[model samples]
Target: MGDRPERIADVEGVDLAGKRALVTGSTSGIGRETALALGRLGADVMIHGRDESAGEAVVDELAAMGREATFQRADYASVDDVRALAAAVREWTDDLDVLCNNAGGLFREGKLTDLGVEYTFHVNHLSPYLLTAELLPTLADDARIVTTSSGAHRGVDIEFESIRSVDSYSGFRAYQRSKLANVLFSNELARRLDRTDRSITSNSFHPGAIPGSGFARFLPGPLPRLFAALGRLPMATTVAEGAATAVYLAASPQVEAVSGQYFTDCEPETPSAAARDTTTQRRLWEESATLLGIDEPLADVEA
Candidate 1:
């Protein structure tokens, strides 16, 4: 936590009073900003991150704003940690109104999780997938699942075999593929929820090119310096701006009936051809469920 107290800014035309939201990776950057924004709009916000002190600081900030808030700590790299997080969330609330999957990063040196999945894929995709499935029973009928995807996913496609194999791993490629998985996961999840008559909406968004938001800090070399310099340039998006679309999807009434869409800058946008493939979306969903050992169809898991 920093010496300065957290700043609370009011967002107009949005009121989340009586609603509950869980925002992952809220220790800093866009995730932190998003959580704070939700709190400003009067949501009961649960801020999550691996750092206990930072998470507690955010909880304190939200509490100061007269919002009900709590902190939960979990490392996304471990499946067991994800399960613990989901269980803790269930204990905290019986019905969740918003689930923001905003925890992710680039692993410069390729590594594998204990489950043998590539580190980037495991954290950025599989962990959120598993967490969302495990918490399905607690979601409200009109709950929003806002996944923080990336524009970097434009050309990448999911490589099921490669996600578990690091023989020729490239960190950038793995991250891109994981972002693609976010979009595909949202797509398939929306379809399944529709079939099951659940009003839950699933959507993913590109947070824009945010340079100071931990996206480049993990780069192996001068790339980090390069990105840092670029972040100071006038064209780069700030953390607050990067969080707008997610906040929009989470609280806006215009999208109340919208689902299975890719969004950028608070507007529905078409994803890459690969991301739009129905068959591929289905395959990715089923494969993700298989990898997570989830036997139930996720759409039917509601309580």
Candidate 2:
């Protein structure tokens, strides 16, 4: 699923020794690879996931690399849980240098969470939105924010009303909308950060189809088996290949002044017309804050 494997060495001067980073959903797959790559390059990483054991295992692995690591557990379906994660991170460090909003997945059923939002959208889009708001003050000046979007975002456009409840639901469609929201939220965040005169840059990327990332486990019936088989194919995208753009966005000096862009294989590319709509971007940003019941962050950005 990858065109060319992008390596950490591809980006020069990527040493992150004095940086502190947090990667959500770091327990496995692309998230794990992204977190580890950052740690290996010298960023002390905070790992997050629902599984305590798996989360701690990542932390321990990072520790062995001599990078300070901590594990924070939270359920993306719960707003309080997401807030608690950011609060816990605040207690650990005040100068977080890199934030990878890499958590989220496709849910089999489209049901509403307690937050009255569809499960997939809430977990993949809203949770990260809330977490970013909660942790804004904690981010270091010039910190990097990288969100893991997907090429799946290409064809879908989000319906703000439908996020509250889906009547005729298709899992794949829900996933596509959520991914599109990732791009919109990311681009909008970059605009807001810049308008506010903040140096924090926000960007998102498509990590090619990674069949081996254990993501196939969520697929229905025989599809999981099909994906498992595809994972072993010579052309299957490796987890490292899937994680490249994230590492590039997180640590590369090339993008130091770059923001609000969609990327593939470490190079900026134009997203779908729907994804690039600044009108939709602002709409999504406002709707997200309303759903989370929080005052819009960086009020000055919009003022």
Candidate 3:
């Protein structure tokens, strides 16, 4: 997680001039900064969030920079909403070149969603998984999918039984499980796509602990205030710093050949051993499909 990959300077020269991109959760914090960065590189961007006014503000900013920008409101907590978001994106462009599955959060309440799934897991992992699957046909041939994972995924393993209920749920533990699922889902997606005709690549990354990135607000009690205080420290990771790896993975030429990897600070650091397990990866994919009541994606590609 060190060596920071030169932050925004790493992707400065990449030109994505007619490329179209969708960055979910772009209305604030790391997502907003990532949207702006991609727009600066000349990719017409679709900004996504549940807030219309905030989404429009980002769109306006991108427009000021001479990039085409539009807003779509979708809450990741609902499968219907994710489907609608994918439909809306398809209407905008069939050749989406970059898809950043960045709209995730820490749900401290640890409730169950309508699907009877843990809210944290459903929001952070399953929703992105569904969105990516829905958009597979909509992605361009060589599109890059960048997911926002975290260093917190290191110790835990994915467990469907635990995620289906909230009893014994600890916010941090649920978060760790969900983030781990993000990597597994991302790696599995890359493997499945590799079996197909397209040259798409999928990768996940740790954005570091960014205090002002709006996630801290979900922390219990004075922890949010403490996180804010830490943000003022001399070398605290800025919100822009938190988004740097995502921007790099989305646009940099250096990683165009990389797939199914977990990155930290824009470098391909090996994830936990559990995350690297292919069996777990594929199982998570199949189970996710079953939970959503959909046919297994890329099923004809073979195991």
Candidate 4:
């Protein structure tokens, strides 16, 4: 924990006037901070969450900061909800400049959604996948999609057969699997977008651990506090600081031509073997399309 990196001002001086960005799960934690940072950079930001009151509060906070912001609520677990959210958001603006798929949490037990996907897979992976796919038609060329992943991905391999395992499960293991999926999704998606000539880019990151963020609210109280205390001793980055990498990936000129890369802090890094395996990457993309019931395969990346 002592070696955890400090936040750097990576996106300083970048301006995003006229750009409309949406950050999911933004009612609190890194998502909230990311939304604010984008607003501060002059983007018209949309704050998203399941809680309407909390979402409105964030929108109000953004307004007070002189940033144009709005709120949208949806259970990311619900595919219909995400589809409707995409359609509804389109009414406000024609083209989205950035989409941050940041909502997700670790559940202590395995759960399933109406869609029959495992709860962890739904919230942590499928929700973002479905939402981004639904909204693809509305993104501008060079539009950025940032997925907040985690170092926990190191815990698991890409297990197609066991990914949705309900019988054998641990909160931490499920979380790791979903996070690995994020990076895999990003790699495949970057390739897909490259083939389409649309210029949209997708990338994922390891936003350093923020121990007591909303993601842990489901955990028993004393446990989170204990981790928070330990985190302050050098293991954890604050939510505001944790958001720096994402802001850089979305706005910094250094990465303007970079795609299909995983980042930590402000620099590109090699992801795990599973993340770099092109076969696994393509398999995950195809599996995700089937899981989401999307008939058309994503466009192939031009070789």
- For every model in order, what is the number of clashing pairs? 0, 0, 0, 0
Which residue pairs show collisions in model 1? none
Question: Candidate 1: worst 10 consecutive residues by lDDT?
Answer: 1-10
Which residue runs of candidate 2 sit more than 4 Å off their true CA positions? 1-9
What tens digits encode model 2's per-residue C-alpha lDDT throughout 1-303?
A: 223223632653468898999999999889998898888788899999998999999999999999889999999999989989999999999988999999999878879999899999999999999999999999998999999999999888898879888799999999999999999999999988988656999999998899978787787889889988888899898788898889888888889989999998788889999999989998999989899889987767672
Worst 10 residues of 4 by lDDT: 1-10
Write candidate 1's Cα lDDT for 114-203 as tens digits.
Answer: 888889998999999999988888999889999999998987879787877888889889999999999988888888888766799999
Can you give the TM-score per candidate against the true fold?
Answer: 0.93, 0.96, 0.96, 0.92
For candidate 3, the per-residue lDDT at 136 reads 90
**Residue 50 lDDT in candidate 1:** 90
Q: Could you tell me the lDDT of residue 255 within candidate 4?
A: 77
Question: Candidate 4, which segments miss by more than 4 Å at Cα?
Answer: 1-7, 231-235, 300-303
**Model 3: per-residue Cα lDDT over 1-303, one tens digit each:** 232323453877789899999999999888998898888888899999998999999999999999999999998889999999999999999799999999988877978888888898889988999999899999999999999999999898887678688888789899998899999999988988899999999999999898877788888889989988998887998888888899999989899989999888777899999898999998899998988888888888847
Candidate lDDT scores, in order, read: 0.86, 0.89, 0.89, 0.82
Instruction: Please tell me which model should have the higher TM-score, number 3 or number 4.
Output: 3
Q: After superposition, how far is residue 19 of candidate 3 from its true place, in Å?
A: 0.8
> In model 3, where is the ten-residue run with the lowest total lDDT?
1-10
